[model samples]
Target chain A: MKRYLKICMAAMIISGLLLSGCGKKEKQDPDSTSQSGVMKVGMVSDLGGVMDQSFNESAWEGLLRAQNELGIKIGYLESNNNSDYGPNLESLTDAGNSLIWSIGFMMGDAALEAAKANPEQKYGIVDMAYGNNTPPNLISVLFKSEQASFLVGYIAGRMTKTNKVGFIGGIKGFIIDSFDYGFHAGVNYANADVKILRQYVESFSDAAKGKSIANQMYQQGADIVFHASGPVGDGVIEAAKEKSKWAIGVDKDQNSLAPDNVLTSAIKRVDNAIFNIVSDLQKGKFAGGATVVYGLKEGGVDIAPSSDKHVPKEILSEVAELKTKIIRKEIVIPYNAKTYEKFYIAKQ
Target chain B: MSIKAKLTNWSNSAKRYLDNTFVFTLIAIFIGLITGAIILAFAGFNPFESYWAMAVGIFSKPKYIIYTIIKATPIIITGYSVAFAFRTGLFNIGAEGQFIVGGIVAALAGYFLHLPPVIHAMVAFALAVGAAAAWGAAAGYLKARFGVHEVISTIMLNWIALYLSNYLVMSPAVKRAESEATHKILATARIDLFGVWKVSEQGMAWRMENRFFHDLLKPDINIGIIVAILLGVMIFLILKKTTLGYELRAVGFNKDAAENGGINVNRSFMSSMAIAGGLAGAAGALQVLGVSLECVNLSNMEGYGFDGIAVALIGGNTPAGCFLSGLLFGALKYGGGKLQSMMGAPREIISIVIGTILFFTAMPKLIRYFTSRINQKREEK
Candidate 1:
């Protein structure tokens, strides 16, 4: 009985502390307090969260820049799972954000649904192209990621000493398919004799599987590996570091993660695309119901600036030449298996 | 003297009430909130305002409440799955695998079979549950016959299930064109609430007349919550009243003693796992029919099963306890996003609070020790 009394007192004290801590503030809706007339931009991150240091992080960097330059009130919500996509979009909508950005192709359906539901709410999504069925209030932002992958693949083909290179992907969707086929085309163009080992981790976030696959590829005499698998690329870099091999990073300049082992990164300028969209909206030039494709010609994709540290000057010059060729429509990079077959036949 | 006596009587009764499991959970929750407050203060945010923002985020809109319930629905069922197994002395770590298996089967059934509305959903649910039950029973068989530790086998099975589900989702028959996910389930298989009415013009006109209902029904509001709650009650009753439950509990308590008492311990083990798997599979099926409507090609485990372990632990492995705890977790998750949007607080703050709560809940002995130490000091005084 005495013990129970002691427990009761402890419970009372804790509850008292909690109540007292909250009692000082009146119940105020945070949404109600936002000042009107200032355009607020809200972003909903995919399951990768903002700190993923890959695709999502690049998009966030764009938002941060807009916050600094455009003088717009900016905020973002991180989604923990697929279930959070709808509610996160809804919350951003309820907050009266003038424009909402859904970062990642995974949120394409959710963004479209939310835009249809709230006709007045303007939305922009990255990496998803809804050609004909796009809602009137939503803008689709796409990147020719294959252009950058081909450049990195050319570097890997030129630099490999063991005559073997590898390509690791996250999933087999059309988006990732582009990365795969372009890499194959670039490798074949650079050195037709070099064997290209290909595999998919099937997840954008599984670093362990990525590392193991990279290790196996390295053991099988592949000297350079290129990965487009989001955080899974982190594992590929780690494995490269352990084996003293080389890894080509994706989406961002990932040289900082492994300075010595990273050959280069296939840079997809998600940050630039996002900033461009926000600035366009700010300047009253918002284009909705349109698919905006960013390619090498538009400066949306390129090999990393850090390529000079590992890639030879001659190879870098050759990559530059290829980039110009692609931009000038002199060379058409294949983005899928069928296109790759046609391109391969034409090149032969 | 009369007033003093009355106060003492009231204090004694209050002490008795505080000795309950519910009160203990409340105390842990308060401690968690306090920890979160400290973290918020350190991070340069006003803790009070941040928590208030979270509360408003959840309760300010009817749609938020519906979202919370939707998030809670699967975890609650999964919690019951884990709780049921724990009560029967089995640690069902493969609830994740069972869940994926269930989702895969349900997606196949929902898309391939063209039945009438109610009947289609029922068939999908049945197939999902049965498939998952078989998946769980395989682990049980390995344990019962080969003397394998369930923990090891279930962990391996989890990987198998993940790969298998991914393969199935990507297969031509199920795969949606140019998409990573499978085709969406047929309309007949969907269990969404007011499915036809919500989309129809007449229903829109009616909703316009009723604004509150219009806002409330905006989410994928479905019968998942109702089904979860009914299963919780049913599970509680089965454990308390059924002979099968008695046999399972007896085996869990002492296998040798139960064997001597004419119980088939091996059979009990298999039965417990099958039931647990069925519950988890039902969670997956409901999630497919009521929420996602398609099976996604997973890159990694979705983690509902692992979260169930925490839910069961916090709920003290009881059906009623699981329901309440699952709701608490769901509210925290849905509400935590507001902290990021409104307060600019890192989402990790919410994770820290939940971790602290789970840590405290796991150490009931330490709490009791502190209480006893305080009582000892009082006696000395």
Candidate 2:
């Protein structure tokens, strides 16, 4: 009996060893390697990574498309924690990527550090680029999202049923505030008497705070609200939909998300910028040494017209004429509160 | 002698098996339930729906699963690095910094040195490991030579390592002057995505290994998985068979008793630390060689080292246990991102869940007591 027990235990141990050996080579998708010729594109996911449908996903979609079309290799490292950022970035770079990209503004410091250390290799930073001292080989692709945001705000002001217009902003920062300022401008242009209700969540990704803020705005008689938040804006839309109030979206074409409630979205077109960078790299026309801003003329920023459902056709036609006027330098859209105050003569 | 031996043997085997099946699962579930509730409550999204969303989001697609494994790779490697140290009773809690050391050193080597693929990759790993091991050993030496507490020493070393890596990146020579990350690691040193798919280029010959699983698994997940498995087998072999493993355990269980058994406690502590540090250093090397051929920006907070503590704790500080725990934790991180998108769960929820798990982990005695009481009631019924 004892001998039998020994035999059984030995068998169990042997099987464990065998299975482990098998698991090592079993290759659970990432565990195996296949060499190829295409320039490998690796991404170190920022605070949110690929799953962040708003920012990181935009970049990821572009890279994944590049992988499929160019037959290039693509991989991404998810930053599990803040410290994982460096290692995750290193992991993708080590994996034979000629270009490594980190998605989001938070990646600026890490990207700046890594890109500077490796001069021969090209790098890209999204959102905020180093305006203080630029790198020669690194591409700092920025967007004048405020320009498009201004146009959307004009639309919201025109469309609001109530005289009180609201701006639910995600934090009080230059990039985010641009959205608020532009929306406020649109509302003011549509009606000088439009009462503006503005408040910030102090967070980019907090939907609860966004909902609460939007609810408060609705309670304050804001029949129409515009949000310049990231994924957190989804909550603003949800609150609007629930209250049957109108809302505007920022970053990408989120107008369709709440077709009945969302009047329009100021498109940042992050995906367009990402695709441009990849395409530029492929064509060897990749420009560096300066900040690359994508504005209206460059097709980097605009309002999503096609996605709008409740927006009147005449209003859309008017927006187009207004867009042309702005593009031709006939009507300059003001973004900063100081600038808006200068044009409209508001006290606060 | 026979009866006494039989009783001891039966209880030992039963206890070992019972611990494996019982301890982690019950505690893990309790933590999961609590974490699940938080997701539903905070985000106003239903918890069950969010969890299902996470599960479906990750497991439903082939590409997503591959991504999940790729995500799990570094965690497993870092977990191994920490667990190796735990075995030696050193608790080299500096794996995060070591992971960064591997990355930056490898990036420097990759960007500067031009060499054959094998050589470039090997050198990067070597340098990273060397840096991490040196860092870990310094802490060990301070403790051994000066009787400094390792817990305090390793923590201090972690901070020093963090600043040093960040300072290097911020430096003009090493920093990506225009960007946030270091310049790309040299071409030869990078882990290839095509290599992950096993597809050859238009002109080049199929260079090396058969890698039949390339189509089955992704490539960037390569070397780390191998390291993790090898570590598990090595730990098992060493613990069950080797003199060093026995001595380390003796000291871990009771230092005075281990000394009475004629083991050199100081040497054991020092050597264990050295081995642990070496493993962490090796992890750093892998971070550069096996994944991204670049250095992590140290200025920003990264958690490989800190998480290593949690991984070791959750895995019960066993090599095999850490392997499983790391995989789960890695999956949790990967899935947490999905919960945010699909179910609107907050990114912070993942930390809450892990923290909750760690909380329950501290109460093993409570779990044992609860389970025994339940068993007694069942028997009476």
Expressed as tens digits, the lDDT of each residue in A56-158 for candidate 2 is 7777787878877776777666665444564445434434466777776767756775565445667777776777577787788787776787777777777
Q: Report how far residue A220 has shifted in candidate 2, in Å.
A: 46
DockQ for all models: 0.39, 0.05
- Candidate 1 error regions (>4 Å): A1-36, A157-164, A188-197, A212-222, A330-332, A337-348, B1-11, B89-91, B137-160, B170-180, B194-214, B249-262, B362-381
- Tens-digit lDDT track of model 1 for A212-313: 999999999999999988888989999999999999999999999999999999999999999998998989988999999999998889999998998889
The recovered share of true contacts, given per candidate in order, is 0.43, 0.02
Clashes of each: 0, 64
In model 1, what is the error at residue A20, expressed in angstroms?
9.5
Model 2: per-residue Cα lDDT at residue B192: 43
Per-model chain B TM-scores are 0.92, 0.81
List where candidate 2 sits over 4 angstroms from the true fold. A1-348, B1-27, B34-42, B191-219, B370-381
Best by DockQ: 1
